[model samples]
Target: MSLNKAVMLLKIIFILTAATSIQGKVYHPSYIDEASTFASSSEYDYIVIGGGTAGCPLAATLSQKYKVLLLERGGSPYGNPNVTQMQNFHISLMDTSPDSPSQPFVSTDGVINARARVLGGGTCINAGFYSRASPSFVKSVGWQEDFVNDSYRWIERQIVHCPNLAPWQAAVRDGLLMAGVSPFNGYTYDHVYGTKVGGTIFDKSGYRSTAADLLSAANHTNLRVLLRATVLKIRFDQSGSRPKAVGVLFKDENGNHHLASLNVGEGKSQVIISAGAIGSPQLLMLSGIGPKSHLKAKKVPVVLHNKFVGKGMADNPLNSIFIPTKKQVKQSLIQIVGITKYGSYIEASSGFSQSSKSISYHHGIMSAEAGQLATIPPKERSFEAISSYIEKKVKKKIPIEAFRGGFILSKIAGPNSKGHLKLIDTNIDNNPEVTFNYFSDPFDLHRCVKGIETIAKMVHTSHLLNLTNDDDYSMKMLLNISVDANINFIPKHFNDTSSLEQFCKDTVITIWHYHGGCQVGKVVDSDYKLLGVDGAMVVDGSTFLKSPGTNPQATVLMMGRYVGVKILRERLGSEAGV
Candidate 1:
């Protein structure tokens, strides 16, 4: 062959390789990009606001059919090694501060909770606990069978949810069980969710698993993830009565605003809000799609008067009782459990094997009187009621003095009290007023009291008692002594345990599980489409009508996948060629 011809062929091959690699490249925009460049561009079929949880998956799925653009207000998640490692994610929370680009939203009320402002969204900074929705929750929301079935299949295929227990997690679970705490079945069936006597733990696969998994799986061509890009507003076509979301207005790190209009047919464009409970509602309110009164008060014109935009906020209140362990367990036990349950994945990728050791146990009070549980008003349900209910249930389940070892009781679904996320000021950049109004409901207060009492009972149980040494047991004995004793034992360590109600109020902390605000039916339909808004939807936990009974990450992913399929099917038709 001629030398000239060979050179030409080589050049063609080189160009092809480069193009393919560029298509596969993951875009990680920083805070330094010139905003003017993004503002001038006018290309994209679908613009997904908030590149966290739901947005990431939506981008990957829609990209299969059309050009998709994902706008994240935060920076790239790749630089943080702690985010990649599972065990490190928890500790990484300590590093999250007001200054971090990965967390753009901050609680005005000082509370330490991590929200990932990175490309993967909250998934980049979560505990990596993969729990499915409770059956009762699914049925309550009226999710069609087809939708529910598709969600399960999509999750199993996209997100690996089998137990990834590390050795440390296993040891913890075993120790807890050996000390008489039973594991609840983790799976759910119908209105019944399964709980086991043993706690479930995930392996050492890194903490952040959202974009790393879905984007890797879909392998789409037209999808682009733009980090450090915050959407400032949604532009609507002014000519129409029911305004159409024609484009989105976004700002890069330089504070420059860019507008990208919808390019339909090339791909029908729509905005999917997966910016999490706080961000999604904030964005909606910023764009004039919130409570009319609040919007007007802030001098922002109202486009949609959705009173429920940020009203039904909910989160799990965790009250931990630290039980002193007899043995100094190495943290490596976390890795061991992961290898045991997900050995194949660990061996194949070396990702799961090195995963962290995070153990979570689930135990709750089941009302024996059935409908009697619903007697309290939903909004009026306080932590006290929740605590009382727990006590009643525990008294029925086991003897109050059955537990004697050192252990902690973590309670989810503490209260049913509602909270609101209102605009703090006219400035869209400022965070909203987030009041959990935690423990405001009577049921919530009762449940907390009961939860504490139940924990105390477990501490006195035989199994727990056997694990405690004589000295520790004697100390407990002294606290229980009567006033008739010659020397009154005012045990300093036991002062915190004097009363169940007091113990609950002092020890209970937010479990970092927030949801329900902008809930389904009230704000949006079951499919997550806004009740009155066209060309927009809320796809985060904000749309959850009622808080599910476990970690919500898996359920959130399922909702995203479910919504993605519905949108795709509607747009492309069931038989349309991909």
Candidate 2:
């Protein structure tokens, strides 16, 4: 070979090697757990305290210009089929293992819901429904519209899928409109009132695309992702009137403590808390940056006394009704939603019945519903999970039908109701005292009652209800059916409106969309910086000021994309890397 030809081949080899090395920067939690590998004293330009729905994308975007460390308290979602498959959506929630993606926790109000613990956070286990923030919601949160639009496009290209609705989902779309949700808006990424089909995170093949996919956009040379690295606390500098978050102390898989600090630099060096609704405020208060008196009660030394950290915690409480049909309805999650003239919102899914496994963990009103569904008085109604095997072996041969067929849920999108988190123990591993205080305000209960009535009316008008038999049918009869729970006041029918109020109390479930701990207006400034802390910021669902009036995953992703670009824009001229 000629010397010049050999030299050219060597140059190509060197270029390829360099590119591969750059993309291999992310590490497992144990890599940093070792004292020698990652000394207790380490630093970075940005330390993101959660590898969740928001944290992953935000870190990816930020890494384009500067160094970023993303620490997650759970395992990676890459190989976990329970998390990666849309079919295992319910199974993931029912998983009882310590490292299960969905960590079940009971709120003080007796609400039974799980917290997301996998690297992609809630997106790993949530129903995979996707819808953009309402224009009003975007405006209320004080976002720049053009940036919001671009950000949505950027993130959507990575994870959002325009789904082809199943037979059941299509029926739901028509039912929503028939129920007075009004003028069908057709397929849209835009969120608004009235019946409309929206985008989803689940693709046509039933494979889920999560925020973890967005990590592909990261400048791998500058980004480091560590899993099972639980952040214990955010350490702060208290020399000034307000505290400044300088570093985070985290525990690795081995329970060894490590600290990540801001590198010696300018204003951009900071710690960010995107630990989610329950976790963000919990960590802030653990770091001594919450309501002064509440911190004092928890025996945590007050660092900043920002009263709003854990205040105004709100969840879109789901009022659920399980409809039994003679024909099997295809299994699915939220695909189409109904927006009422009132503030309430309605959505439906098929094959999404609360599991017998989860029923074992029931508390409060959930226990009542679980009890009613349990202790089967002979197996009358039944539904088999549909799969290719079932289709080929059973369904194609015998025509087996599904019994536990329909799922209907109503939510008060803009709830007047609110709750707060209380510290149960100073130990960071212990779950905080979560209280929904649902129905504490009667007006809130009134809205829910009205929503229930509207759903009942909608069910009657829905073509979906045609599957019911003449013997046991009608929305009133469905409401009257209950698990053999010995609760008093068995409703004979819905004729007496009085029974409806009691019914609402009996079957409420969380759609699991928890928002507001470090809220936008009250806890963080318009820029998403902590109100009383410097060198820190929060970018997650907790930052939402109002409910999206629909499933909130899309809005949360939009926030992640929006905040990431905003940080870059803020340091446009000043930062060295940018």
Candidate 3:
């Protein structure tokens, strides 16, 4: 070989070695020192507590211009194989209960539903079902026209919500449509905001993309996300006339106390709380920002005394009506579509096949004939009323055929329920008591009962009858229509004659759509700035003024973006002297 060629080969080898070393230096969970602790006085430009739905996006966006610190109560999900895989979402559900201390996820009073506790927050463990809030509901929250319009466009660009065409979702969709459950085809983009015709599924990529995706892209050295760092209390500056949120006092998994504060002016710092509905309110109460009466009971010194801090607690009550299928579904049809279309795009990096195969069936019942129920006084609403309403709705909706063939009825408890989150104990680690008082409002119960009856009619319709009949030889017979077939079948399961008033009493659980505790117009202003506090802001589901009549993820994300933009504009304007 020529001498020149040999010299060139050595130089190429050196360059390759250098690149490999740099790549290996990338930060991973294992590299973070678990034992290494941060000081109580250590400060940053922005301290975002609770790295869930709102926190992640807020941190990701603000980090672009400021030095941000994200604090989460849960541990790092990075190396955990269960969090990374898509199918593991269901598996992680079992680990998400409030009682499951080992897991970071919590439920109301320690019960588990669908919330997550990892780095990406709930998006990491949620079913990845993306739906926008109804525009009507958005307007009710005092969002101006321009803000709403820009939010819609910004969210679309940030998180991609293509349809889920997976085989599993496809099968579910086909089964639903074939059975007369029509697809909601109207106004797909803003369907979640107000009225929805058909259920929208999660986009493919196998897994739903979360704030982790965006955060990963930013990868700035000035920004840091500390997981398993639960905020115990908000430290206030005593020198201020009105207490200012100077820092956060948090505890690690090992139960060691640490504090993260702001270095304002010189560094210009602020604290954004996005710990979720339950977590955010609880944190405020612990820090002495809630009702004076409640804090007096807890014996915590009151700082702000906002009576509305945890007052307007609200959640959608969901009742499910299960209908047995005649044919054995081998796999969910939507899953197949998601796998093929979304999977293909992920692998080949081409085409419009961006949706996944998760199927959702949503049915809305709005009646001009039906008048809105009278609003129940907050003190008068009770659990009994809530349950009774659900039962009444189910009975009215049951079809004669459904009476013959068993069909499960799922109803969303109306938006009038009055509930609150109160501190059961002074311990920050202890879960707060969440009084859902689900069926408290008579009107809420009435609407739910009406909704059930509506669903029953749809189930008994011809479209459903044809799909459920045992025409296929391989399928099991769900309903028997032979002359000698038991007539009691109709009366037994779908007994319309009998009062289903007991149904709600039997089964009424929160739809997991808890909101309005630290409500807009009440606890915080429209901009999400706490009315009484200077440096504190509540930007999670708790800030929702009213229930959006659907899942709250999209709206929550929009709120995060809105808050981020507002903060940036204010800070940047000050800096630029505009």
By summed lDDT, which 10 consecutive residues of candidate 2 come out lowest?
377-386
All candidates' lDDT scores? 0.53, 0.69, 0.53
Worst 10 residues of 1 by lDDT: 342-351
Q: Report the alpha-carbon TM-score of model 1 versus the true structure.
A: 0.72
RMSD (Cα, Å) for all candidates, in order, is 14.4, 11.7, 14.0
Looking at model 2, residue 116 earns an lDDT score of 85
Q: Rank the candidate models, highest lDDT first.
A: 2, 1, 3
Model 2: per-residue Cα lDDT over 154-269, one tens digit each: 98888888877877677667777776787888888887667888788888987888887888888887877877888888998889877878888888777888887888478668
Give model 2's TM-score versus the native structure. Answer: 0.83
**Model 2: per-residue Cα lDDT at residue 330:** 65
lDDT of 1 at 191: 21
Between candidates 1 and 2, name the one with more favorable TM-score. Answer: 2
- Over 4 Å off, model 2: 1-42, 352-403, 469-495, 573-578
The best candidate by TM-score is 2
C-alpha TM-scores of all predictions: 0.72, 0.83, 0.71
